[model samples]
Target: MVDAVARLLRRGLPVTLAAVDPVLLELRGVLARAVDPGDEASRIAALDGTLRGLLARFPDARYAAAARALFGLPPATPGMNLTARRALAAERAGHEVHHFRKRVEPRLIATLTAELLADADRFTHAPLIAPRLAPVSARQPVLADPFAWEVAEQEEQLSLLWSAIYAARAELLAVERLISLRAERTDIVRAAVTAAWRWAGARAEAISYTTAFAPDLTIDELVALAGWTPPLTPGQTSRLTEAAAGGVAREQFVAHLHGETVLDDTWTTGLLAALQSTEPTSPEQPGAGGSSTAVPADPDQNG
Candidate 1:
């Protein structure tokens, strides 16, 4: 199934990403189950989203680059013939096309197949959360049904939590960029950036860290621990160095972590809105609700 889809994508898009195509005929069952039974546009969006999500989400950087290039996905240039795609993949990943064909290609197909099947299975279990979490806020409330007012209150809290997490992540990526630009400079300026990185990372990775390592720990416990720990003062590089050096090396580590973090754990509107579009902003990124720090009105818009 995945192989057929990849071949279709390689042939290229508008055709590949079109609302309807003879190419999707063989994959109809799985695609139907994986997405909400809807018009052509919504299904296509879900399909494209799933493909990009899976491709961008490799724990291995080389594998991700190769897979994205091979599939004509983002972070990879979108249009290329088979030969050109293979060459681009080789260049980006530093792995020869022969090795990619022998090793990476097969693995990527297998992973894609598994994820697609899992999505189908998840749809089979859709009564669990899918409808409740649908992106329907533009019409009616997504959380709880029209009748469930009591449950709506709890869902509102979840929405607020989702908004907070989204804001923190946008800020965290901002800090990540700042630290990256000054990575070569080990000055007090770097120290300030690092401080912001730590603070932002703490919030952005909170769900991951807590879910993975410390589910039993409480917010108060974390606050007490923070109070007891030494201050992250100027000239302090130890924290950053340890974080960067301990695992997958700096660049790959950040790439992998950031990839994993671009998710909506709360299944709210904020994340989908952020993902739909991005605009160039000079001062800083926009936060949840499309608010930005010191952002000016669009020059194209009237007051």
Candidate 2:
């Protein structure tokens, strides 16, 4: 009987009518039997199995819609099974005896509805489903109800909408992270550039101090004026000494002193040389002894 009903449903009978009619007839027949009380249990189990099989096979939007309609039927408190009776007896004296209507049946229906809806959406939108299956036009109408198909399509649309929302959110987060990284790099570069500039200026002044017989100069004063840290490593110190001795200009010397890692050594060296070579005062006497200090006009003004 279960197999017969399943075959009919697969052949596309209206599910509600097909399920209810046969089940009612079977129950009526079981009740009419006078000899065996246990016969009713077998009949009820068969009906229950049939209902479950139907739900399992047609877990889709159309089936769910049909099931939802079925749930609206007048509530019928069928005779309790032995298991239900035992469970009710085991309940504590003050506790309520849980019934199908109060505790389990409604929840079961709701769960079935939800599962059907979810499965319907999953099958409809699945990329693997539509392309591999025969086109609706070529297949017999027996398996292809447009109303059922539309519910599945709507589920697919919802899936696509959620995917789009998630994709957009992911893109926005990526863009935000990119912007933050760019800002951090920019700040680091700016600090590096400023440090390089000041180091170059100080080195130029240091070279002047060493070469000229001017007032004694402190390393602290040189660093403060130049706005840079002196190279601490021996390799860097050697490089600066070599460049200074090679007649590298004040700007170049300053850049070299600032350290190669912080600045572009070649460009900084070139800039320093340009500044030093174009000085208005002679290199032989930057400030002469006991005489009025001669101030060279601003290099920008001269330019």
Candidate 3:
């Protein structure tokens, strides 16, 4: 039976865990009924052999690595700052995966297996099967009935074996849940990285536009046009100076200046009105001219 289980697991743990779980449960049930005080040594040895055989097939290292992979991992090459942040998030997720696969799971399986195997030895070889009628004190010579001691010990073994079986079953359920959780975490990190890249793309566009348009604007206006809500820090202000020193292309700068002027309605309107007012009025023809009339100024009126 152990060989069969090991073979099933070795074929493919991802596919066979479900299949093997039911078989293990059925074996637990059979072991529960077959437990006898007189036959405990043989029963325990048989259970141990089966469990050992199964463990041999599904080696700890093999299953542990598979479990780690199932819990998803971060990308190896994090190129950009945004990518690095995404990688950090994935690494944290990997830690959780490792905890379950490397530490928690193996211990649980080993513990339950040990408990079942130990039960057989304790039940069969116990010095007393039942409890004594009277309590033995340090001053009194010890006396215990072997038959009663064996009975009590066997009962305790049964309880422990049942508990081990239940605990192992619960651990298997936890493994299933962990598998689902790993997939969920991977999706969350992937979405976060996608969002970061999108925002970075937009920022790149802003940087390109500002770099192209900076020369047409005053240092103060260029800073304003950077569209930063908070005032630039000292370091950022210095970086802006360095960028401005590189300068823009002559044609691009002049074209941007021209566009700025064309777009200013107030300045355009005022300049056009001044130009029109300064133009000379057409001279009146002599034949069309009339006699001029003049009025004397009164003392009360100022010239």
Candidate 4:
């Protein structure tokens, strides 16, 4: 499987990731299961997209450079010859050609293969959760509508949750778009995207915490969630909360995004505060949990 994967990756481009050679059949099967089974083009595109996504998230710069040198992918000169590629890889990996060829190259490919397989599995599987039922009285028809009522015990206000998320994410998307701009630095682009994903993690955590109990809630349960295994820090729930009120984290992060010029954070904080202020008086559903789980308010509001 490893040899087949290596050969297939050597081919690199989506157009060639097919089973023309008998050796690629195993890898093709894996790709088929992970993406659209019918369309060859779609499957190949999915594989390429997954590979790019995996490379982008790699923490170490050396791994990224090695991948580029090994495969003629983005940020790498696809037309480079073999000696040139190895020389580039050696330079980036900080090793002589022999040591890199002997040690680093093999381990790097193995890790890449493992990550690709895991991405396939993630696409194919989802955890199943049992649905909680509503109370008998809660199901009774309203006075105006004799036959209308919801059956689910909990109601996550998806629209409102989505509205706030969309509003906040709009700015992040603008910043990500800056990657295409000639003036933007790669590090700045990375910072913008990381903050965006952290916001997404925050949303997932909020939904999980608020719904884990239709009865009540606690902080300990939330802490038990993200382990060291996930890319995010386990203790980010508090810091995630701080981003709402123009917290220093968001302020500094946004400042960096603006290329070291610190600007007002009301663009985000005001938007978040506006969302939370609309919260219902009583405990609301998950997703857009009661205002307590909201992205924090503007620092001015606190004073």
Candidate 5:
């Protein structure tokens, strides 16, 4: 039976290899740990130390050279970062789940059913002649025991069949879930991309405003470039649109539209006073013309 299973797997080697390899490696590690935890730890530590030494010795080695330097070592590819490793592990797990559901589990069920059927056949066709009967009075008797055995075998086979069916159903459900998770993961990546683009654009806009520089394109152009369309009504546009027919300046617009001040006037006044005290102000300054005189700089600089 094991040989038959081996042949079956060999025929489907390409399909099964990826699904089985990780599982086998993990199982081997577990068994090794169980057999000698200290030995396993030492082995791992030695391998890690060897790889580190090789990396230090050949910091610039590429491909084949790198592989040769770290020969007999486990994977050390930096590209397989923790997150990538986790994703790969999840993919492997899903594949293994699929393989077990499709191949291994079905074989086990079939084997059990076949064995039960053979047992039932043997029980139902057993010889029932009595050895103690005299030659002339010999009687061929029915085998009640065989019938009982056949009934037991039938029940066992039914149970096995149900178990196999249940297992297949479970595997199907799990595969469906795995597919759904993959789709969800894709959606998450897309959402993250969109958010990143929006953040970058907003940051760029803020920097442009702070620098008092006109952007290469207008806000409307930016919106168009970003593939967005305004959904605001006329009233909403009046409230937010700086150049709308009934729009006010940004500060006043925010205050009136939101029914609250855009900023704390007290805080603004205090900050402006602080800034004024730190620097000399000209009497001809527009907003500062009626304000208090600023401090004068050192006379040494007037030379």
Candidate 6:
């Protein structure tokens, strides 16, 4: 499902992410029932049934969109096996769960939706989630009213489908939260980057620090001046670092060391070098100097 969605995004399809919210909310409810400690046998039976129904619906829900996008046709016949369907749903759900507290990329949700829609043809040819191979003659004798029985069966399947969705609700919500945070983080970074660029533009040579009575600022300190946390990726960190380091000469990267204490120039140099390096600096690097002082920024400055 993840791969499919990525492919769709790459294809530039305008898939909607709103379709997933309801699916996730339903999954969360399913999980809630499982977490409850009552009626063990009934719970197991219901869970099994619900999962089976969802295994069908999961692919059906996305197939229409995928088929429409890929072939300009309606949804094709379902063909994926039950196990494959379940695996796809669970795997995608688990990914969102993993990113619950982390910053997710803003484009990820849309990309996932597109990929799922793109795989309509494959899913159409897949086996049923709950295939029926029982003898048709023997099964016919059990029902009093075939039409009523079929209607009831359909209702039950619908119920089970919803149950399956509720089961993974928590994970879906987590993914949603992560995606939201990612957008927020992007905005924050944009503002910070703009500020850094402006600061560098106005400065001549390098931005001096008030280390006269204070200590030298470290790379980590510079990051802090940007006003964010460790949620940033290596690429983002590097971009921020580059923005802050702009216009400053390598020799004057850590300028203005004026404390009574002896400043370790190597520590400052190493940190600046790491920040300026083309490759990302390792987290274990000495750039986050433990004894490094803070670089005071202007009252109105963003960096």
Q: Pick the candidate with the highest lDDT.
A: 4
Candidate 2 wrongly placed segments (more than 4 Å): 1-183, 225-231, 237-303
- Candidate 6 per-residue lDDT, tens place, 88-143, comes to 33343344423421323223334434433433333343222222223556534436
Per-candidate TM equals: 0.42, 0.19, 0.17, 0.46, 0.17, 0.17
Better of 1 and 4 by lDDT: 4
lDDT of 1: 0.45
**Over the stretch 1-303, how does candidate 5's per-residue lDDT look in tens digits?**
323322322222121332222222222222232333335443343323332333333322232232221222124233343333333323433435345445533443244234423433433442211112125566554457987766665544434333333333343333334433444323322232222223223323333332343334243333222222223344433333332113233233223423221111221222233233544556632135663222221111221
* lDDT of candidate 4 over 1-303, digit per residue (tens): 457556654455442645323333335334543345455555555556666666665546667777666665555577665566766777787889899878887887787777766655543442211122335765543445423333122233333233434444554544444433432233433434344434544455445435653325443333222211113343443334444323234444433334211111222322223233544433432125444333322232221
What lDDT does each candidate get? 0.45, 0.37, 0.34, 0.46, 0.32, 0.33
Q: Rank the candidates by lDDT, best first.
A: 4, 1, 2, 3, 6, 5
* Residue 90 lDDT in candidate 4: 71
Candidate 3 structure lDDT: 0.34
C-alpha RMSD (angstroms) for model 2 = 34.3
Pull out the clashing pairs in model 4. 245-297
Q: Candidate 6 regions off by >4 Å?
A: 1-117, 125-147, 166-170, 179-303
* Winner of 4 and 5 under lDDT: 4
Prediction 5 TM-score vs. true: 0.17
lDDT by residue for model 2 (132-227), tens: 122475643333788777666555543433333333334333333443344332333333333333343334444444334224544334333222
- TM-score of model number 3: 0.17
Candidate 3, residue 253: lDDT: 25
Stretch of 10 with least lDDT, candidate 1: 260-269
lDDT of 2 at 78: 32
**Of 2 and 3, the candidate ranking higher by lDDT:** 2
